[model samples]
Target: MDTPLSGSGNLPPKPGNRPPLSLSGLDFKLLRVFKAVVEAGGFSAAQNELNVGLAAISKQISDLEIRLGMRLCTRGREGFCLTEEGKLVYQASIDLFASVDSFRDRLSSAQNELTGDLNIGVIDNTFQDPNSPLIAALRVLHDEAPKVRLRLHASPLDDIERGIVEGRLIVGVVPVYQRREEFDYFDLYQETSNAYCAMGHPLFDVDEHEIDVDVLRGCEVVNHRYALHGDKANFVTLDGQSATASQVEAVAMLVMTGRFIGFLPEHFAAHLVRDGVLRALRPDLINIRTNLNMILRHNAPRSPLVKAFATALGVDLKAL
Candidate 1:
């Protein structure tokens, strides 16, 4: 009897059937090239993006199509377009590459070589306190994971929370006065803010007297615009300014000029008080206690890098 030919007519086949391809059999490099081509809108654009020669890219695409036994792209005068099969393949490629990247990030983090970009949003006032433990933790994290890049964003508490929710920020350090169910919170510390003013301000000398709320009615207050709740009516608003020096040094510089009175964390004003640049307006005034929280998306995938950074900050990720 004559031997049967293989499906591709390359050789005569045995009785057994061909084995199916596994995940490993998928050429990630080729898939990446294909994805770049689709996204770049043409072969030339793909060449520029992939930094590969035009002939090489074309050969790779042709090889990929031959291996799959299907045409993935259609080229015409208008431009390159994806066929139905190409669209499906591109979607799969997106998901596959995203998972692979996550896996690599996790592996790197586990090896304690956690090196990657971390975009962190923070309430500008959190760093105002000179004794803020968060600052110390950041320094330690840098010393340990020097390869990890840190991007600091300063915004209002509401804006910071919004950034975390919309996936712009990987993490946020904010006051948890307005906790929402959609967010996960890690308690960093508790801070107390007291009203303060310039040393020579009239309110600074008020003692043994119940300071009338009217006294502050017309005063120009340099408010830390991020405070969730505070005396709102008495202030000439300088909104969106930070009360924290370490994070918002420019705002602090303005504060140092003694042109405005504002609420400041007690720890932040100690040194400035000693230097007589600022002083408490009324030591007996109402104090506001706020919890400093590390906020992240509730449903966000926990990456090893994020966990490591949280650990360094004394946050129990398990509880979160």
Candidate 2:
């Protein structure tokens, strides 16, 4: 007779029966407050964070529950706790704010005033190479997007490549040994390295004629961990490997100990050689030539900053 009053005793109508809520500015404000309250663990704890009084926050939460036609949280003696519906809403709020922030970043990028982060990963010792365009590209990025924050990480090639694939880095500069399908490689330049011995090593003062392949093969050497997989390993015999290093700097340290021989990029070794700190073992017989490349995920869309960097590096986008 009386339409059963919608749910038998004035309880809020079932979720399916209620009309959907159309979000307004006020709704956003209320949700923001609700988010702060939940994050702070209770209304009283959120006062300093929200900069509002307890009564005002309580009123806002009550208003939000009324507008949604659902109980969002429980408070008082039992302590603040979210209802099942409240938990779902809180999770959705997180995703919603992220999308909003992304939209803002997109708008800023479109206006040519990029103000988000640009993460770049590179293999160590690249800055010392006069041929690398990385320094010039960084200068260009700084001049153009002065507001953008540039984050640079120097690590091993394998770590750099992994960072690019996992979206932790926008771009990576590394030596290409074997190309992976996951990356779009843009050629940067080549580097040359030769085996060397430090000042205190036995061969540092040995005559060239006395250092034959057999003599070198019998000496202790340091092997690059990453180069063990391909032809790169074949450049120098690994039979004498008594130590392993992941970085060129580490290799230098080992070589300097006068107990191991290791390969180093010519440019990186030049100053050390000039200072009489190291001497090349046999450049003519033991050397490796590697092409360095800039890599990005083949499937991911390039960010504006990445595009700018590629342009600065003179990479032919059409080829990629």
Candidate 3:
């Protein structure tokens, strides 16, 4: 059987093209059970969550395999393992359910009610800054839409950008230097970072007055993974020992090793700099000014909740 992972109530005129059975004849509970089994790892492991006996769970899975006319998994004392077909089916099921969820969210939005999941993706370490307005924006959104389920995730700049573009994320908070036409961005705030040298580094003991671009160009410096693209000219670099890190903490750790000098968000590096473990290298010339922006996909639907959240986010910063 070639089951249409998603289905309407009626079957097609050409039976060979799709499953002969219509969706109305199928029980969604069985698909839900199958999902639970996969997520929980096996029938025995999923018993509690599924609220069913082992025999029943096994029978349902067998029925699902028969319905689809394919073997989805293998089970034994060796434990459960999905077949190659099972992996594709699982991913399709996930996308199907996600679409259903989005459909429900759209219905809720149409009704002028704020309900359903709201996904927010942000780059790592924004919470460390005292001036960050994310918390305040969340509070405002929460008050306005008490029923909304907000999911907050911290990811790398690339992952955050992908999330927003894919419609998996409603909004993203990231530092913007390179803008994508697919997204509309609002400048949230300006953050300053500066190059730093660990205690044992040659530049660490160099006097502030003597520190210059030439001095920085003499040592090995770390760069962000995405920094090598556009804005490469803006970054201070040294010869021979360049390294890359995706996150600010990883960059800071690289700098702390005394092997590579790197830039860090001032708020993130403040404690270390204050502890005398590292020195901020020539703040006057090496300060990296970044405009942190809140972004959303240009094509995304502006739901009442999304608009409300954007309004709240922009009130203080005038970012939107």
Candidate 4:
């Protein structure tokens, strides 16, 4: 081994002999803030999620960067963007949090009663349906496990699927695209939709039978990123500037512009139809029936809260 000494020096410290940095001194709160900011794309954007003021979050992130001795991101007039080091840390943080969640779930399994948060994601505009039964099911779960916290997210199909897979969301109510071996899916119910046009739309004056697929091809319509490719046939997929909306309300608003024709849930469009704001075209031909499915991971041992809510949902749905 080389001597711990250098020329003209009695002794020199070895460069690689220092102790490893211990994470035990790190504040979990600071790390959590860092994670939130990373996921939220910036400190200001994550204020609500962190439930703290902007100054506090900024300080926490600064502390985290100091502790790690690395700059994670840049935020200013140019907007927020993660640095190269931030990307690596973000991925590592995801694994860390997922492991922590698994540990919590294992601890939960030791108890007989259900207690903890149960995240459920559903598509928008379905709550108005009396037959949806989400309200009834939530009521049942609330009574059965009063300690269980029921959280619902009315998000798009992409968020629903990704959230569940990542454990950010525990359950999802959505139209299943393709079956995944990792997930257990239950057929909940179905909703029917039809192509519609605003009163000022060109098709508004066209005869129902005459509004065929060929004519639809020439019309502009509001499209969704998650819209099934097969369902494209139902909407006359047009060529030109693509107008895509993630939220159902945004889609409805786009269709209401009188320039685009798009699909909307029949139940949701009922009021608009009655008000003469929109009219259905070729309902018999452009009809698309979507099957809503309840999705959850199969490999993980589900919390009692999940099971109880699922049971409640089934019971309530059956009553409908």
Candidate 5:
């Protein structure tokens, strides 16, 4: 008679007890295929990502299920869905790969010279800051570790922070608006933003003295989503009408429409001001200053690559 099935819907044990599965090169390859399939959602969709035919992908999945003695997922007309066992396996695979990466980092750090990937994330628009030393830091990295691979990603501050926490990025440079316990922030520099108006705006040619809070109360101002104003920086807070933009570029685009006034970093607006495209309302009274920071995951292991990059950026990790 056929043996009974388990609660997991997996077939019964094959006669006597089986030996423990030993991972090999093929197992790793199969796991990678499994991961790609899961991330891509289904076999048909994963074809392009895995660069393999659907039949081969299906066969590999079947092989993985047979090797582990469990049904990892359900596919067919009902669509792709992970079994409870599959969910656990997927999570375990994520941890396993992270460990492997960490081991590689440790091994590279143990060597004499820095040789590994340093993924850096930065908030958008910082390159325009006249005081930014990012290029100088990059030059230091290049000079010190010519063999190291450098990768840069530009994103919003929140996204940059998330990337660091998730191990997708090693370091991030952004303005410190709200502090999180998961990160250690280092002071880098300061950036100041001032209220600005485009050439066609009514306030473009107004005297600096005439554009006060009362006057600004009649016009519409574009709000930057990540902008955090202090007690003294209420230029946009005491507004007449409000609009929102997430990026500085978008803020500049809105200001140029001849309708909305917005705030921008001094360096970012300098060229526009010189070209007669934008004007600062009142740099003395209508400005906000914020500190730019370099952040890293607080408890993450600092490989030599990370140490070298932090040193290049003038952050004393030992001090922290």
Candidate 6:
């Protein structure tokens, strides 16, 4: 009855002629040089740091400019400066190199029995607190991972967040006045703010009743520019400027001049308070409470070192 049909009639032959995707050419050496130049602030400095000839550095940068079809730097007698494109490229290079460094660190950690690099960012005031959990955690990390290299960066909260976002810092500890949805913040500790001044300051002996907000209205106050607060209600605006000091130590030093009073975290000012170097003003007047948090990018892939550090820090990585 009908023609015999072979099983191959219904099946299509396998295709074997697909072409592979072509990848864009990238010169890692040029990228490295670009990053070095940006960091060193000029070609000569980068040449010195990289230990290369001036001509070689120049050629490499020129090649990079040609490859990207953009003028990266402006060369003149006033010294070298990055152009708009150069600025963007420099930022990109920073991120790229940071990722490469992290990758290398992870690989080295895996290969070596006990070694790795951990990049961490902390607010200046956090470390100054004698009872800070970070100090204890660092001690534990040192004991447990003795061979691991630790890199700590202390800066303002905004800079710390930028470092984390740019992949420069693996983790950050910052004061959380408001929650950010893009990052995961683990509550570490809670603290209260209080007015502080040097032992010799006039306000040091002021009575609680006289230490009201009105009294602070006319007094010179040194405010920490990076402190977490919404309203800044109790702050005494000196010269109509809100930011005078970026670090808590700077604020403390300013207060030591006996010319200004500052608001400081209870734990941060505890030692000075105990040693009679600084006194609190109307302890009841300062009622702002804030929580210190361990922040990390929500979608970042955690390496073994990061996981271990998080565990040591008493953070539940899985939950985060």
lDDT of candidate model 4 versus the reference = 0.75
How far in Å is the alpha carbon of 75 misplaced in model 5? 12
lDDT, residue 303, model 5: 74
lDDT of 4 by residue, 31-145 (tens): 7777778756787889888788887776666666665666788888998888898888776776676666656656776765666678799987788765576888899889987
What residue runs in model 6 are displaced by over 4 Å at the alpha carbon?
A: 1-30, 36-71, 75-80, 98-116, 142-147, 199-202, 208-214, 217-220, 231-243, 267-277, 284-287
- Per-candidate TM-scores read 0.56, 0.66, 0.73, 0.78, 0.76, 0.69
What tens-digit string does per-residue lDDT give for candidate 5 at 1-320?
A: 11111123434345477887798777777787887798678999999978989988887887777667778899999999999988887766756666776677777767767766687999998897878878899999999789888889899877888778766678999998878999998888999988889988999888887889767657788878777665333555444445788898999999999898888999899999999999988788778888998898997777778888888988898877
Clashing residue pairs for model 3:
none
RMSD of each: 11.6, 10.9, 6.6, 7.6, 6.3, 13.3
Q: Select the stronger candidate by lDDT from 1 and 4.
A: 4
lDDT of 2 at 132: 93
The 0-to-1 C-alpha lDDT of every candidate, in the order given, reads 0.69, 0.80, 0.76, 0.75, 0.81, 0.75
Name every residue pair that clashes in candidate 1: 128-244
Error of 1 at 205 (Å): 3.5
Residue 308 local lDDT, model 3: 77
Output the lDDT of residue 179, model 1: 75
Residue 12 error, candidate 1, Å = 48
Candidate 2 global lDDT: 0.80
Runs off by more than 4 Å, candidate 4: 1-26, 180-183, 205-219, 229-244, 315-320
Cα lDDT for residue 31, candidate 3: 70
User: Model 4: number of clashes?
Assistant: 0
Best by lDDT: 5
lDDT of 2 by residue, 14-106 (tens): 676666679888778888889889867899999997998998888788777766777899999999999999988777775565455457668
The true-structure Cα RMSD of candidate 3 reads 6.6
- Model 4's TM-score against the true structure: 0.78
Question: For model 4, what is the error of residue 204's alpha carbon versus the real structure, in angstroms, after optimal superposition?
Answer: 2.8
Candidate 2: stretches off by over 4 Å: 1-105, 229-235
- Clashing residue pairs, backbone N/CA/C < 3 A, model 4: none
Q: Report the candidate with higher lDDT, 3 versus 6.
A: 3
